[model samples]
Target: MNTPARSRITAVLPAHNEVGALPATIASLRAQTIPPDRIIVVSDRSTDHTVEIAEAFGVEAMETVDNAARKAGALNQALEILEPEGFVLIMDADTQIVPRFIERALQEFQDPDVGGVGAVFRADPPTGYLELCQYLEWARYAEQIERTGKTFVMSGTAALIRWQALKDVESRFGSIYDEQTITEDMRLTMTLRACGWQVRSPVECQSTTETMPNVPTLWRQRRRWYLGALQNITEMGWNRVTRRYIGQQVMLALSVILMTTLIGLTVASYAVNGFLGVQPFWLVIGAVFAAERVVTVWDQPWPRRLFAALVIPELIYALILQSAYVGAVWQKLNSSQGEWAHLGTPHKTTEEV
Candidate 1:
C-alpha cells in the first residue's frame, strides 16, 4: 500500500509595511505540518523591511508597485511570474497559523469539487478589552460556520484556493479578485459560487490573527469591510443569497433605528414626567444576554465565563460596530466608497484570501 501524494501548495502573503508582524507569519508558514511547496511574499511598495524579512526566511521575495488594485495586483503580479497550478493559500502578513493549519485546510481538497476553504480565526491571545469582545464574536461566528458548513466569504485572513476554480474566476472577470469591488473576499466567494464552485470554511481549520486593538481602529477596519460588502451586494444585483444577506443587514439597521428612537423618547418622557420607564426592560435584556453567553462559553475558564456574563462590554462593542454598517450604507449611497486598507494596515491593501 502506498500513501497518496499531497497536492502542491503555495502560500502567498501580500505585505505593506508589515516589518513588525512578518517574522511570526513567516515562521508559522515554515512550521506548517504539511508545509507549502513554496512561500511567496509580495512586497507591495513597503517602506519597511518586508522584503528583507522574506529574503531572510529564504522564500521568494518579490517587490511590486503602481498597484491601484493594491493587494490583488500584487498577487496577480506573482501569478504572472509563476504558472497558476496547484492550491494557493492566501494569508495576511500579520497572521500566524497553527502548526496543522495547512494540513487541515488541504484535506478539504479531497473532494475535488471544493473550490475554497476558509479558516476559523480566533484573535491571537487578544490584548485589551476591545479585542476580547472581538474574540468572543469570532467564536460565535466560528460556531455558526461549524454548524452550517458555509460562510459568506472565504476569509482573506487565511484561505486555500483551488487553482482551477481561481482560473474560472480569472477567465470571466480577468482577475481572481475583482479590483472594482472593495470587499474582494466576498466578491471572490460570490464569483466562485456563481461559477459553480463549492466553498466552505471548516471550523476545525484554525488560524490566529491580531484583532483590532482599539475602538477607532476597529471602527475604521469594519467600516471598510461593511462598505465593501454593500458595494458588492449592489454590484451582484439580485444574487439570491446576497439579497438575503442584504435583507438581514436592513433588519439590523431598522433595529438600530427603533432602539435609538425608543431611547430618545424614553429620555423625553422621563424629563417631562419625572419618572423612569423602560429601564427595567433594558436591564432584563442585558441580564438575559449575560446569562446566555456565560452558559454558552463551555469549557472556558471561570474568569472568561464571568467576562462572557458581563453584557456591558459586548453591548457597547455592538452599538459602535453596528453603526459602522450604517456609515457604510451612507458611503455606498454617496459613492464615497473608500480604499481597502485591510485590518488597519497603513496603506493600500485589497485581495481575496
Candidate 2:
C-alpha cells in the first residue's frame, strides 16, 4: 500500500485564547517546505483576539459549537467539518515546526500501514532555572526517542496522521478523538496501534514547543498528563496493547520509590557518620548516577552541561515529577477528574519558539 507523493495535507490547530502565540505558529506553518493544503484554527470559546489573529494571517478560523471537552472536542469539531481526504496534522497552537517538518513526516506515510509520524521536540530557550532544567529534560527525552524510533505516545505538540487512521478510529470508537480523556494524543496513538496502524517518531521530524514557566504550572500539567494516562489504560482494559503501557507506568513508579529510599538512607548514613566515614560502596554508586546525568546532557550548552554535572538540580526536577505522579495516582484511586482549565496560555511576546 502506497500513498501518493502529492497527497493533500491539512493542518488543524486547536486553540483557546492563544492570541500571543498564534502568529508565530501560523507563520511557521506557512513557511513549511510542504505547507498544508488547508490550515484551520479551531477556537474553543476563546474570549481574546484568537480568532482575529488567526484570520489576520489569512488562515481559516472558527469557534467550537458548545463544546466542553477542551482540546479534543475542538479537534473533533474541525475533523467533522473538514472531513479531510488526506493526511491531517494536529498540533498545539504554541508549537512551531521546522521548515521541513511536514516533508519529513510525510515520508513515513509512504508505507500504507503508517498511521502517524510524531515530532521530536526541544523546549524553547530558557528564561530561568526551571525553564533551563525543562530544556535539558526535553533534550534527554528527545535523545531516547531518537535512539528507539518508538515513542510511547505521538506528541500532541505536533504529529502528522493519515486520514484512513482517523476514519478507522471514528468508525470503531465513534469519534476521531476520545473527548473524555485529558491526554488525547496518547489515547489516539494507542487506538491506532491497537487497530494495526504503525505510529513512529523519527529523528528527522522535529518541532519546538513552550515549556511551563514555573513549578505549580508544571505540576498541574504533569499531574493531568499522568492521570489521563492511567485513566486511558484502565478504560482500554487489559489487552495486549495496554500491557506495555501498564508495565512502563509501574516501572516509573518503582524507580521513584527506589530513588526516594536511596536518598533517605543516604541522609541517615550521613547523620550517623562523618563525611569521610561513609561507606565506599555508596560513594561508587553516587559517582555512577552523577556520571549518567552528565552524559545524558553532554551535547547541550556548557551551562546546561554544568547543571547536569551538579546532579542535584535535575534530581529535584525528577522529584517534582514523581510527586506529581503520586498525586495523579491518588486522584485516580479516588475517582476524581482532572481539569482542562490550565490549557496553554499565550506567551507575553511573539518571539519564535
TM-score per candidate, in order? 0.90, 0.94
Model 2, position 327, has a per-residue lDDT of: 89
Cand. 2 Cα-lDDT:
0.86
Stretches off by above 4 angstroms in model 1 are 1-5, 278-286, 340-353
Model 1 residue 291 lDDT score: 86
lDDT per residue as tens, model 1, 275-353: 9855788788778878888766654667777888877677788888878877777888899857554443453232212
Q: What are the per-residue Cα lDDT tens digits for candidate 2 across 173-224?
A: 8898999988999999999988889998887788898888778888888898
By summed lDDT, the worst window of 10 consecutive residues in model 1 runs over 344-353
- Candidate 2 has a TM-score of 0.94
lDDT of model 2 at residue 108?
86
**lDDT computed for candidate 1:** 0.78
